[model samples]
Target: MTQPILVIKDMSIVFSSPDEADIEAVRQVDLTLTPGKTLALVGESGCGKSVTARAVLRLLDRNANIPRGSILFQPEGEAATDIARLKQDSLPLRAIRGNQISMIFQEPMSSLSPVHTIGDQIDEMMILHEGLRPKQARERTVALLDQVGIPGARQRADAYPFELSGGLRQRAMIAMALACTPQLLIADEPTTALDVTTQAQILDLLRQLQSDFGMAMLFITHDLGVVAEIADEVAVMYLGDVVEQGSVYDVFARPSHPYTQALMSSIPKMARKAERVRLSPIKGTVPAPKDRPVGCAFTSRCPYAFEPCATIRPERTEVGGGHHARCHLLTRQPVEAVA
Candidate 1:
């Protein structure tokens, strides 16, 4: 069996507050990513998907702390390093980030510098990580821009981020993320801001790049359509917990958790007029971290929630080949009996 490149076990993220109680944004979440495979982390907004991804890079805010968990990353022919324990500005971490692992932010405009040319920005990464001279780095930057389908890459590289359109800006961000040819890439809603055509193109570009580089990916998004297209494995999160997880084919084929089922039902299905049905919008909003339920975080919103769901926490139950769900309904007595 192939070994996993990254493993996150029982990770919980908490944010400190002065007057109020500390907020636990993520709770005991586990994820595994293998080399050259894509694992999609799907959930609604404020569901801790982004926070969990950021933890792998040790990029959380100062107020945020990992009270528990281990983020173990194994580089090729190297010993496993626990990223969770590394200091934010440690030399070892600085060497690993942007070299072995890179991240693409949700917004290109905000992530890219307005003062620097796109070429300079991308070149800096190569200079820092690969120790390449300015002249050589510029050559590689232009090639990277072109590789990401940017038109007039040589000239465009000299232009500031504001000079490019949304699609071009996003492409530049991708180029920068790929400059060092990282072993793993964390993409946090990389295509969320683009138009439909641009979104598809970006997705295709990411897939092509992943194939070319043979790198693992942690794809974070709320869109099921995008997940279906780019993901090999899928983990469905709700509130601060991973409710269901399995292969893309398995989870999409047979979603075991109620939250997962609700999310699937909310998708816009393309079918004949006779077969069409109204979209089922999931009721209730996600509770704040401080307001998280004692048992299942999604108990307030879960339609199939039972008596045990409100007070007694449920453990993960196997749902066949490598598939699992954290739900009381999976292991408890019949739903009708509980109801």
Candidate 2:
């Protein structure tokens, strides 16, 4: 197997202060991202999709508790380091954060500083990491803006986040993410709020940038359409657990888990101008973190669930080459493959 840029093994996360009960948000998620490839982490809201990405950057709230697991990250030319064990905001982790692995947040307007020019923000990373002088950093910043498809890069660098259009602000965000040419990029729903046309443009730009930089990307989103467009591998999450994972072609063409099947079916397919289209919504709501089912977290919502599915926790088992799913239904005959 090729060495993965990141290896998240049996990772679990909880949120709890001294007085409150623990809210388990992520449960033993294991994911891998090979160099220069895009791994899509797909799931609906509250499925720990965003939380998993935040955990990698150690950007969780103060109450976050990671009791088990290791986020082993192998920088392009360095030995692997376990990020889970690193102290938050420590010098080493700080250097790794934007220098070795950077992230593009979901909301560019919120992530970018309203008080500073976009150039100032993007320049800060290179200045801090590479010790480039102010003039040199500014030049690099303008070049980055141009690289991410921002028009009038030099002038745009002086603009504030609120001053730019949504797509432009997102382009600025991508520019910041690629400023250091990090080994891994974690993009958390970076195109959620944009129009379809703008979203397509941003996706295309990201694909081009990722290829040019040769950086591994952990793409987090609930949109299967986006997954189909950009992902090399797909991990389907349900109620804080990754229930199914495989190559994008395999997972979309042959979803092996009940939850994955339902999600794939939920994707909206275009119809002829005259034909009416409908999405097959998933049957039940996601269980609350505090009230998750004891056996399989998705058992309550799984249609093909059996007595064992409701009584015993299903373990992840390999269904095919590099494909695995957590479901008791797989223990018997194979689940029906969806198109």
Candidate 3:
């Protein structure tokens, strides 16, 4: 759509260890993000959400591997570049890492330096990318702190990660990520481990700031409720593959995949005294990435599965209006839909 700001084409990622067979962390996944829009990648742990996000930034650990993929980044004024092809720690990639693209990791407490003050931490990125002197960086850091709703910006900037509450630390992380005004932000569950109220506040802050900065976001989260609250588009992953992708409204209101239907039914909803709604949990666990089925990886857990589901991987088929699902059931139209 509109020559997406970021387009991932047939991307795959793997993790290899000397003693073990290669584990496919990500399959032939494809995703796109237009400018100023948010795409939520939601799935259970090991569904390759984080790995895919990390691949965009070239931030995976040493053991991780990518046999093939192309992450085409089309920053406004520049020619499109394949971030997946660029060397991870090279100069060009480095410039894009925190300059054009920044990330707010899941655990600021662990990701943030234990040795530095919050102000210094935020200042580092600006200094590195914007070439700001200490004084200017500090001044802007204070401003960003205030903008992100961290009270007493001046004094709190001097505090350490341990000194601030979980929420405040997350705010500081956001401030730091915004220091360079990146074109895209990959937020790896930034609200994880926070209270519900705090999560809502952080989500609100993220939406406000993303709008203000006009940056695309790849929001990796497992909470469908949160997806409804913030996402414009959503990609549902299972066992290293994206089984469904579409507008949040379309996907949530009319889920096509059996996996997606099961996921939707599991969302806890509010009900009155006479309207008790029991959650329909999916039947089985996700298969191990290293030894998943050659066919639809979801067949082991899918309820409407048929013979082909166990032998051939279903290609993505359109349900309606840009909504697609990779389930064989999509072929048997009037047969049976998940209850």
Best by TM-score: 1
Per-model TM values vs. the true structure: 0.96, 0.94, 0.95
Q: What overall lDDT goes with each candidate model?
A: 0.92, 0.89, 0.89
Which lDDT tens digits does candidate 1 get at residues 1-339? 778899999999999988889999999999999988999999999999999999999989999999899988983447789999998899879987888889997799766999999999999999988999999999999999999999999999999999999999999999999999998999999999889999999999999999999999999999999999999999999888999999999999999999999999898777734785788899989988888889988889887887889888789889998999999988876447554
| Ranking of all candidate structures by their lDDT, best first | 1, 3, 2
Output the worst ten-in-a-row residue range by lDDT, candidate 1: 330-339
User: Taking the candidates one at a time, how many backbone clashes does each contain?
Assistant: 0, 0, 0
Relative to the true structure, candidate 2 reaches a TM of 0.94
lDDT tens digits, residue span 1-339, model 3:
455788998899989999999888898999998878999999988899989999998999999877887889993437889998888788889999878888988799756898899999999888888999999999999999999999999999999988999999999988988999998899999897899999999999999998899999999999999899999999999989999999999999899888888888887677633677777788878888876888899888887778888789899889898898998887866757678
**Candidate 1 regions with alpha-carbon error over 4 angstroms:** 75-77, 273-276, 334-339
Residue pairs that clash (backbone atoms under 3 angstroms), model 3 = none
Best by lDDT: 1
| Superposed model 3: Cα runs more than 4 Å off | 75-78, 272-274, 333-339
- lDDT value, candidate 3, whole model: 0.89
Query: If both were scored by lDDT, which would come out higher, candidate 1 or candidate 3?
Result: 1
Model 3, position 33, has a per-residue lDDT of 86
RMSD (Å) of each candidate, 1 decimal: 2.2, 3.6, 3.0
When sorted by TM-score, best at the front, the candidate numbers are 1, 3, 2
